[model samples]
Target: MIAALRIPLMSLLAAAVLAGCGPNFAERSKTAEELTDEVIYQDRRRPPSRLRDVLFSRTDPAKVGGVNKYLWNASLEVLNFLPVQSVDPFTGTIVTGYGTPPGTGRAYRATILISDPALDARSLNLALQTRSGPVSVGTQRAVEDAIMTRARQLRDRDSRF
Candidate 1:
């Protein structure tokens, strides 16, 4: 009688333990499309995606973030007149202390942000400031255009290899 009860009790304990286990591997594993959908359409209540941050986060061996190298080089080349204060290649941001452009009496500072790896207009953002205050919109746009153009040229030049 005790042996019979022991078998039943053991079976009951096994079932209880197994019941707490989460879904099987097949159910837990998500397809690429499913993961993409879930990440893009995440609910407001949930915290921002740690996965997205990891995927896009810069882990380049040479730099801090995954910013476009071409754009970064081109930005420094184009704005070489200014004194660079800080640069984060991973995020593609270059901050200049202050320097007068050649042939200009006015002093100016610059902050360049290359947000994407693509050599495109939208990827480059330029903020220029004079001793007085922020520069005009036209000036900022012009700087952006110049950096993007230079970035494209750099990419083209590199691809020739």
Candidate 2:
């Protein structure tokens, strides 16, 4: 019947139209490699082309999440007794669960923040807490001072290289 023919004709017409929507591969155009290169180079947002460059490029240490690497490493080294709960290098924050220091009976937890790129006392923030409550200011300051001293030692050792 005409109605049955109309369905087939419409399908055929739709198929032809849809087929034309694809790229015309028969025409000469940029090859895959050329197209890829164009896309990569044309955009300024693209990362380095070589893996080695991306991995080993000499960038400013301060550019790493605005954190002093010495302070970060020092905090981890000094607080290695505590079990690390979470560490975000990008945010320059380290959180550790309760763990007693060597020769200490009471368990303590710590949160360290490296707020600046400078290897100075002001860049390191330390909060120590015991199961009872927050530790006294003197204890907090002592821990912070240890971290800063260690950070200086690390920087000094690195500078010798």
Candidate 3:
């Protein structure tokens, strides 16, 4: 009968279309098996991880959690008036002997600690001293502000490259 023939023909057409639509899971699994013997697969577990992982890793040789160079240099440059008693770049500490500023009669000393390499406000710690004892809060704050501003300027200048 014509109706029976049409039903079989439609079934055959549907099967053909579905087969050609795309590779099924079995075909995909077979392709993956074939690719397993490739060099890419062999090196998949190699060092340095995948590209995405390396992008997030810390790989910069110059950067450490220690003192920031910009802040260190800026501290020295800003506090050049004071006589440097000692400086340890490895430990990120600067101890200065008391000395009078050019326009002021007050003798001041400073102990600067660059705790971090980032040019952030918290990285630069300034301890100002006078002949009597620690200087006023306003004076300490003003000096800290000056050092932080200078440190930022230094960082910005270096970033241009």
Candidate 4:
């Protein structure tokens, strides 16, 4: 009797542990989709000196709730949706190490040089500085802000996952 009970109890405990490990598959997928949307359809904004804060329902740090507030911070939002491994919000720059074709040389670090904000326009000067030359993300502030607003709504309304 004791041996049989032990087997059943162990199985139950194992089930509970797995259940508490992380969010379910659907939740994980949803989170991934959300992140991608933010990146691909990210707000097209001018370079900002500071990230503006949107009011979101307060969440307890001890609890798994609400959007990642840290991500919403001014600098982070600027570099949130770039095709890069990671970005540093401060100093207004982005570094990417993605490679070209298979036979291409080592991946280059592309720097997106963001300058100060301008009147009636946001300035995002992009300097690939490679064979491709430079590009600009300037004057897309309105689109970027709109997308950011929508993203905030998505997070604030649904607290799950």
Task: Name the lDDT of candidate 1.
Answer: 0.80
Top TM-score model: 2
TM-score of 4: 0.24
Answer with 1 or 3, whichever has the higher TM-score.
1
Q: Which one wins by TM-score: 1 or 4?
A: 1
Q: CA lDDT of each candidate? A: 0.80, 0.87, 0.81, 0.45
**lDDT over C-alpha atoms for residue 145 of model 1:** 79
**Alpha-carbon RMSD, candidate 2:** 9.1
Candidate 2: regions farther than 4 A off: 1-45, 51-58, 62-64
Return the number of clashes found in candidate 1: 1
* Candidate rank order under lDDT: 2, 3, 1, 4
- Worst 10-residue lDDT window for candidate 3 reads 58-67
Candidate 3 per-residue lDDT over residues 36-78, each given as its tens digit: 6565657544456589887887654333336777778888998
The count of backbone overlaps in candidate 2 is 0
- Cα lDDT of model 1 by residue, 74-126, tens digit: 88998999998998886788999899888979888999888876666777778
Off by over 4 Å in 3: 1-65
Error of 3 at 137 (Å): 0.7
Give model 1 RMSD, 1 decimal: 11.0
Better candidate by lDDT, 2 or 4:
2
Identify the superior model by lDDT, candidate 3 or candidate 4: 3
lDDT of 2 by residue, 3-62 (tens): 989999999999999999988979988889778877877864456789998899887753
Selected candidate, larger lDDT, 2 vs 3: 2
Clashing pairs in 1: 65-90
